[model samples]
Target chain A: MSPRGRRPAGSPDAREAILAAARTAFARDGYRTSLRGVARGAGVDPALVHHYFRDRAELFAEAVVASAAGTGAVDISERAQAISRLAPEELGEGIVRSFVGLWDGLGGDRFSAVIRAAMSNDESLAPFRDFIVTGILGNIMDKLAPDRPELRGQLIAGQLIGFGVVRWLARLDEVASLDIEEAVALIAPTIQRYATGELPSSAA
Target chain B: MSPRGRRPAGSPDAREAILAAARTAFARDGYRTSLRGVARGAGVDPALVHHYFRDRAELFAEAVVASAAGTGAVDISERAQAISRLAPEELGEGIVRSFVGLWDGLGGDRFSAVIRAAMSNDESLAPFRDFIVTGILGNIMDKLAPDRPELRGQLIAGQLIGFGVVRWLARLDEVASLDIEEAVALIAPTIQRYATGELPSSAA
Candidate 1:
């Protein structure tokens, strides 16, 4: 059942209040927390939340994107362009440095919360995954390597997801404590190879 | 509070029964699923479940590992030994192949469930993280690169985690459809560089 089902007594600031509450709820308890709880937290009637957002998943997506935009934290388009402009040899390092900067700037708790929210279920995860695929990786592939763009994009996506798990979730000491430059130095070339080098022959 | 507080009526088969039930519950519902439910599913007293396992976290861990062992799916030690025996240059490819084989052999649903359980929360994730660090990556680092063991181990961990997300979680078309040998060809060199190459200078 949709937690935000119908309109209730509305106020001028009701939408904003609900969005703010959503951010807090998602950050604190993840996607499974009900919108009724969010509405109560925002001091709004649950129906008013339905007026602003179509459903829980949309509310979550909008809330995360809004907060990210508010902080100027979701500028993936600009970052994708920057990555694309780098020399072929530097592309991997460039990608690594930019992402490290982005996640570091977001801090662990908020970023992990967002990741956890996205991973909660397929419905919540779809938009985030799409943003990564079509928005970030697809854009980069369009400019960097036009051939086999899908494969290259998946490679990059896998690389970053893996990196994120170790660095953020597992908090492996060496990876966690790495200086940004040192991490880029170690990881960039691997990305670079994926970006520009030939895939090794399976027959070899 | 510890769910498994004390031993209940002991049967020779009780421990295995609890573990089997835990494996089913965790694989079906992940870390968020209740231990009491597992007990009910096992047809054992809830106290009996607590007696056999320390808590939900331990129950989940023992359950996953036991199932892996039962299926001959957790051969990380043997894989580690084989990785160690390889030349440094070959270590990366060897690792990629071994892991891809291991996960592929486990099938998507079970492997993804394990990952989802680990990612559900830090507490639930610790033993799995430790197994990767000490049991898997640490063992490989000891033989592949003795000097920078910690850093090398984290790199390997990150690489594998990223790969798993794409192949299992994201289920990206290209990554999911990749043949094991082809995947090794594409990913091994990146791992190789992490295993043996010099860390890049930030200014470079």
Candidate 2:
């Protein structure tokens, strides 16, 4: 085996390095990025990258999730746990604050990179969408909503994703320029309602 | 002048054709798309494309706005006018219905194309963002909102844009699968609140 592939598949450091490299690669190249390039960036052999990830889609999903989790900052499970613990009334603000905080910390360029990569094609889009809908939003709604948690979670995800797209990706001036606190205040109630409020009569 | 460039710069049909072709080209090639390609697609000379649009960025912005307006359906200004005429209580539902109707009419692939083009780069992003923030959302807020119309408009835009992104672009299963009425029913109240309700004390 080549020295680059000599690292054990079980090595956490090698795995993490590959993910980090994948994030950078996806950000730079979007959906069309190749596994071989990712391996080169990580200084690992192509075989090692394949051994670590079943395919580019898996790597892209995990990289994006890792990036969303803020890499070395706060673990995603911890963040989800924190959100799950919020009182129903506070859920909106908690969710908004947590997402804004993470996005802000990740910085605009990195956040936009993830969005651009996700927008590139269907293959890339599915995993990213799944992560947002199922992994983050659904996980929260499952814990807190009284009815149709799946739908409710998707609704909340839509709002939050819109906020991120407007503020970070699209960089719409009004919302993008707002103080984070102000933004949270403006958006939280809507989120709170989605989390624990009533739906339209027909919807209910 | 060559036959392609011979069409008077004042011809409305030529301008519309160029805009349509620009939309297709941008959707295919994104931010880096060349004006020459758009001209070719429209069967016009590059100079004529420049005559109608100052540059590529302007072409991108106009194409996206044209797409958002729903090429053959209700003109954007008419839709905005209809929204403007709504009573305050009906604003949220009206806004949601209008957007969903337009998006539904435009179909998923076209909507995704505009989004993907917008997400491609900053040069392409600004004009699209301005249209949503200033042109569509801001125009509606200015007519009806009592205070901080710009901010209120943005908030509403965020929700609507999020709805479109989740439903059309990302195609999240829960939200994407929703019938138009159900999706609107779930989201309209929040938009209405943004349009007319009191914001958080600090925000106000």
Candidate 3:
């Protein structure tokens, strides 16, 4: 069934409001946020939240995706479209530019909130992990990479995740201070290698 | 003056005790840990912790390094020496192998504690940041890389940090489930390129 078909009849606005409230709560409290608090924030009944989302984990996953796509930041779908348009060789630079832009646009607190929340509790981590591995990177790899797309997507994820941790979360001087272009220049090749370049023979 | 000269004459064991206590406390409470509590854990007066280390930050830093070294896990210094001994082209594989081994040996909890603590507070992040940028990666670059060591080291740091985050912290299946040698084969070349391969012209 279509996702729209699954929804209970009501104004779609309530759903959006709950998602928006969830984004704020998850960003502020990580995974520990309560559905009642989210419902109150959205001015909806707690039962309505349960109506929209199966549980808190589902809510958090939806909230994170909504936060990434719905906030003033660049939309992930649009960003994915932009990435898809780039020549295969240019994918590295395009991905890095898009990633840096997305995070920079989202602001550090929001970005860190996603990571810190994931790190704070393993159960909370599952949705974010799925969002990253399958929803984002894996989808990109499936479209673009020629071989071993799963590994390629994962390697790219590792590079980008590390870049975010070092530059944004850890705020290391050498990396955190680099201008976007400089970072793109230095990191894009590595990503390019992961995305399309030849990898060493796997021992496994 | 020598470090020993500054210390009050006493058994060397007290200094070690404070550091051990600090490691446990920092791992448990992160940067929010207090000197009095660490001192209590060590069976030493808070004044004694002050005498051995300048402040909480320094103590935390020392404790981290010591934990990396003193635990049954592989020592950072010895790991560095091993990396230094490898041929330049082999550096990537050696480094990845060492990193995976070290983290695996240290066990996930301790490794996560260091990263989680850093993420918890900006003040706590500084010492760990410095340790990653300067103490470990930068030092490696200085001794081994032929040019642009700072940028190379930072890039390498970003990659390794990402790998750890993805593999250990996030536990994404594609990368996380790989045998260590598989990881080494896939990632080492990327590290090698950053270590010695030609980088794109800097925008700066």
Which candidate has the highest TM-score of all?
2
Q: Is candidate 1 or candidate 3 better by lDDT?
A: 3
> Model 1 over residues A70-143: C-alpha lDDT tens digits?
44335556677778787777788789989889877777555566666667666666556665666567657754
True contacts kept of each: 0.73, 0.83, 0.78
Query: Residue B174 of model 2: what lDDT?
Result: 74
What tens-digit string does per-residue lDDT give for candidate 1 at B1-204? 125543346667667777777777766665556778887777677888878664554464467763643453355566676787887878888889988998888776556666776777776666667666765665576555555777777887788878887787767778888899888888887787778766555522
Give one digit per residue, the lDDT tens place, for model 3 in B1-204: 125333343657778887788877776676557789887787766788988775554565578754643443336655665676778878888889998888887765556666776677675666566656654664476555666677677778789888888888887777878888888888888888888777666732
Native-referenced Cα lDDT, model 1? 0.70
Question: Considering only N, C-alpha and C atoms within 3 Å, which residue pairs clash in candidate 3?
Answer: none
Task: Give residue B77's error in model 3 in angstroms.
Answer: 2.9
TM-score of each: 0.69, 0.74, 0.72
Candidate 2 lDDT, tens digit per residue, A171-196? 76777887779888888888888888
- The reply for model 3, stretches above 4 Å from the true place, is A1-15, A20-62, A65-74, B1-15, B18-62, B65-74, B144-146
DockQ of each: 0.40, 0.57, 0.57
What is the lDDT, from 0 to 100, of the residue A10 in candidate 1?
A: 54
Q: Model 1, which residues run further than 4 Å from truth?
A: A1-73, A202-204, B1-62, B65-73, B201-204
State which candidate, 1 or 3, has the greater TM-score. 3
Model 2 B-chain TM: 0.69
**Candidate that would win on lDDT:** 2
Off by over 4 Å in 2: A1-12, A15-62, A65-74, B1-74
Minimum summed lDDT over a 10-residue window in model 2 chain B is located at B68-77
